[model samples]
Each structure stands twice: as structure tokens, then as C-alpha cells.
Target: MKILLIEDDLDLGNGVRIALADHGFDVVWVRQQEDALRQLDTGACELVLLDLGLPDGDGMRILVRLRHERQNLPVIILSARDALEDRLRGLDGGADDYLVKPFVLAELLSRVKALARRSYGFDGDMLEVRGLTLHVPTRRVMIGERTVELTASEYALLKLLMVRADRVVTRRLLEDEALPGAHENASNALDVHMGNLRRKIGEGFVRTVRGVGYVVDTAAPYKVGE
Candidate 1:
């Protein structure tokens, strides 16, 4: 999914951009409020990660303006201000989530996912593609009436692919987002985990894109062994 990241700090903005990209999100980063508003006018981004402090303006105004124009667009406030009043103001000003500075990237990613699930109208805790069901909270996978037990890495990999079914999830994105530390040292951890997941879930559900990555096609017919 595409995200508009409005951050003025060079270090934080770059870090967030790289992290989001690694997690398979297309990010359009702007350091100023005007640029952010202009980007919003284009209606290109699906989500917005906003910073309250900007060079030209306060982000709260942007949030207010955005709410007036696009009430349904999802916005997450990323700011250094941590006072209770500020938090309440942001939440009440149409921000979906407010994350303070010096926060963990993993937590930010989790919030982003949660907000995306809500905004995209996903079935709360469940993510289903074809007959494969993934229980998000318990981390359970079910194919038909049988349960499928997967390793931690395998589950992460499969969950990401399934959540983005029909989209080509890149190798870099899969390694960085799913495998994490295992992807380092140029190891075949992603391949190994993917192979295991395919074996457990049956083949043909996931198709390889040669050197690029993998895609899970929900519409394609999945025969037992073709």
C-alpha cells in the first residue's frame, strides 16, 4: 500500500521511509505541510503518517483541513509532543493513531497494519484468502477443516504474502519484514521457510516470480498436486 509520510526531521524521515519500504509499503515522504497537502490533493496515498511540527505550519491544521476534505482517509500522527492534551487533540482532530517520538519501529508497523485492516475493511482478527485462514491474534493457520502448524518465520512469511494476496511481494521486502535477522549473511532462510510453507499449505497457491519475489493468487484454482 502507498503511504504519505510527512516528517521534517531528516534522520527520522529517512529511517521511517527505509523501514516502511522494507515492509513493502510505497512511501511518498514530504518534509513540509504544503507538500503534504498537495500530495493529498492528488489522492495518491492510501494512508498518511503525519508529523505535528513542520517548517511552514503545524500538522494539526493539516489534519483539520484533511478531515474537512477527506473524512475517511486514514491518518496517523507521529510527533514528539506527548502531553495528554496533545494526544487528545490529535485523536479528536481526526487522527486515527497517535505515536510519540522515540518509539519502536515494530510498534509503528503494528499500528499501521491495524489501521490498514480497519480502513480496508478487513475481517478484524481474521485474514482469509481462498480456503486458507490466518487468525491474526493467535497466529493460527487453517486450511479447510485441518490446522497447519508453521514455524515462526514461516508463519510471518505466509501471513504477509496472504495479507497481500495477488500482489508480488518482493524478495527484499519478504526478507526484511518476515525473516528479519535470518535474512542477513546472505542465507537462504527465506527460501527455506517459503518452501516449508508451500509444502504445508499445498502447492500452486503461491507462484514464484523468478528472481523478483512471490505472489499468492487467491483467484487461481489450487489443485492438490499439479
Candidate 2:
């Protein structure tokens, strides 16, 4: 999953960004409202974690604009405003969920799962492709009764392929989403991760299209000839 984090505090933003990344989310962090808008313009983020305060402008204004621009965007307010009115107003202003600062990371992750289910029908904490079961929250992958251990990069690549199962995921898309901030060495790095994941799972699990990208068949045993 990809998330847009629009928090201004350096410490808080960096912490949240790392936490989200550890949980398998490709996070794009922006402190100012303009940068947030620019990030949103790419239409790459699946969910948003918006703060109510920013240096350039009020995050509420950005929220208003975001709602107007992308009506169906799932936005969760992550702010220090904990009053009843503040929460109520944020909800009324098209926010899917609200989380006050000083909140538990687990709770925030849970809410993110809930919103993801509500928006995209993504299974909460679990994604299954054929017999391969991936527990998102725990970062565990299971094949039948056996647990498959995978490196972080390998897991990210597998997740990206399984999430878009049956569709052709381009190389550029994979680099940008699955291996964010590593474009300098992404070409060879992704190949290594992909090979590792395929070996751990099954070679037939992920189908590689020549000159394109990888794909997975969630509906059945993924066969290259099929």
C-alpha cells in the first residue's frame, strides 16, 4: 500500500514515515501544503494521512481542495486537535477517520486497515495469492503449512505483484512504488529481490513478461504458459 503523509513536524513525520514503511507502506512525506498537492497530483497514493497544521497554509484548506479534486480519496486526519468540535468538524469535512497525536501506532495501523477495506475492499492484514498467504501486519508469508521467510525488499516486490495480480505492472511503476528512493540502483536491485522471492515461493508464482514487468495469478496456480 502507498500512503501520503502530510505532517510538518520533522521528528513526527520521519518517525511515522519509517513506521509505515516497516509495515509495508510506500510513504510519500511532504511538510508543506503545496508539496502535498504536488504529491497528490501524481495520483499514486492509495490513502492519505493529513495533518491540520502546516507551515505554508492551513491543512484544512488543503483538505477542502483535496475533497474537491479527488472526491473519493480516503483521508485520515492526524492532528493534535482532540476536542469534540474539532473531531466532528474534520469528520464533517469529508475525512474518513481522525486520529489525534500522541496516539498508538497500532491503533493508527488498525484504522488504516479499516479505511483500506472500506475504500478498496483490500483484505485487512491479509492478502492471498493462490495458496500463498501474506499477513501484512506481521510481514509473514505462508505457503500451505510452511512459513516462507523473505527479505524486506523481496516482500515488497511480492506484495506489489500480488496486489495487482492478473494485471501487467510496468517496470517504472515497480521502481517508483515497490522500490521508492532507490532508483539509482533499482534495476539490478529489483532483479535480485524478484529472483529471491520466486525461489522462496515457486518459480511459477510470479510471471515475468519480457521487457515489461512481473505479475501474479491470484485466482489459481500461476503458470507462465497459461
Tens digits of per-residue lDDT for model 1, 162-223: 76677678888888767777657799888888898999999778899999999988787656
What would the TM-score be for candidate 2 when compared with the true structure?
Answer: 0.64
Which regions in candidate 2 have their CA more than 4 angstroms from the true location?
Answer: 120-125, 135-157, 164-172, 178-226
Colliding pairs, model 2: none
Alpha carbon deviation, residue 44, candidate 2 (Å):
2.2
Q: Which residue pairs collide, candidate 1?
A: none
lDDT of each: 0.84, 0.82
Model 1, total clashes: 0
**For candidate 2, lDDT tens digit of each residue in 81-137?**
999999999999999999999888888888887887666545446777668888887
